[model samples]
Target: MEKHILYTTEAVNQDGLNGQSFIKTGGLTVTVSNPLNNKPGTNPEQLLGLSLSTCMNATLQAIEREHGLAHTAEVRVTVTLIKEENFAFLVVARVRIPGVPLKTATKLVALAKKRCPVSKLLSGSSYYQVQVVEDY
Candidate 1:
């Protein structure tokens, strides 16, 4: 598989406060709220919150399927941002898995941390390239 796969989505309603965006897949709807920051776009903090929740949820599902156990997994993500000297965000995730063995839960958490796409991306270093285009 290509490391840099291309994923595309469309956004309309540019006049809204956050450019209301939503994607429809199958029978589900996913919406993103524009963060009220200076950038006036989807904030990284919100995306981080989503990513962490997704990873932890997948791990719980894997454990349930493998062990034939039933439980609800509630993930709480707290994000802190520092924008004074430099821009930074800290995401702390607390996963609640009831009726699961401590060791098994730990294993699942570790595996999820390793396998989650967002976790992997955040763990590695990233930089953005910017370019300015002019109309011909």
Candidate 2:
């Protein structure tokens, strides 16, 4: 079996309706922002939306370079949650590839869906491994 290294994130913040959620890693900063909840950070829903598109678009970008396809793609992912319905969250990923044939775009989208890391994670192909070590 091929082995893959995993990563982790440690998020720290305050409690209650107003607090900040910031992640610090490798000289990078990510803030979770939700004004309504008084949270100065991106909530889970927003994160999910970003993740899906990020993955899909990254894959498309890679394919574009590999295939020598000269076209910029506009990717938009919509995530909806209906409490009354049985399905909780539905993610619709749309890609607008200019100068690319419709049939070719469709095929690339399918391939990207299979290759994107976030897509794989959302599809349940990848999972998180959590380990807690006691420090006393």
Candidate 3:
């Protein structure tokens, strides 16, 4: 049997970069914009960062659980927007697993990279960096 999963998020941007509507699959809506614009709400790039970061962390957590390791992980995702012709963006994911051995943390991050769908998706379209910033 083949399995398929589908997810969706709806967004509306109006007044140029002024106010944008964001609707999650759960029906949660909010206004989003660039903080540089001094406008209300969060920015789109940041939202992408948040999504990918959390997804990566979740994957890592699952890995820890699978290995029966008691692990608490901290993950940070950052998106950088480049201003140039055609423009571009970059994503940096930083992970910290305190109380876990460095070798183990490295292994888990490497595994998460393979398991994380978000990283795979972004890797094809943009720059993605993964770093194990801390391990005990």
Candidate 4:
């Protein structure tokens, strides 16, 4: 099988979680900080949550359009950092599609989980989960 790349972007972080991260193409930049600290910056957990939520919702929108339904799906992701023996993260993605039946919404979410790139990448991780919810 041949790989056909649709899009690609590079991000550079020089100071780990203490300073800043920026896109290589010079479009976006963000301050990186520890979530436990009072610093005014973004953390990895929040960034993971944003990535999953955005990717899942965007895939849901495309699926809804293909199914001839309104794009009313909403995705909320929660990422928790755990400190057991080492550092770990727990990710949960909840999706809700208004005006659609629970069963159908669940099916849509299942398809989205299978299709979304971020979801696919995290599917093998035991700490990752995706579920359909009537309310977030």
Q: Which candidate should be chosen as best, given lDDT against the real structure?
A: 4
Please provide, for model 2 over 29-114, each residue's C-alpha lDDT reduced to its tens digit, 9 standing for 90 to 100. Answer: 45655434564665656667787777778888998878898757667777665565463566667787777777777777777777
Model 3, range 1-136, lDDT digits (tens) per residue?
Answer: 9968685566555545556564545465566776677767877687888888889999999999998977698889888888788767778899998888888999999999888988878766547888998742
Better of 2 and 4 by lDDT: 4
Off by over 4 Å in 2: 6-8, 11-18, 24-41, 85-87, 124-136
Name the lDDT value of residue 61 in candidate 4.
98
Span of ten consecutive residues with least summed lDDT in model 1: 127-136
Give the distance in Å from residue 98's predicted Cα in candidate 1 to where it truly belongs: 1.0
After superposing candidate 1, which stretches have Cα over 4 Å from the reference?
1-43, 125-136
lDDT of 2: 0.65
Q: Pick by TM-score: which candidate is best? A: 4
lDDT of each: 0.58, 0.65, 0.80, 0.94
Cα error, candidate 4, residue 117 (Å): 0.3
Better of 1 and 4 by lDDT: 4
Superior candidate under TM-score, 2 versus 3: 3
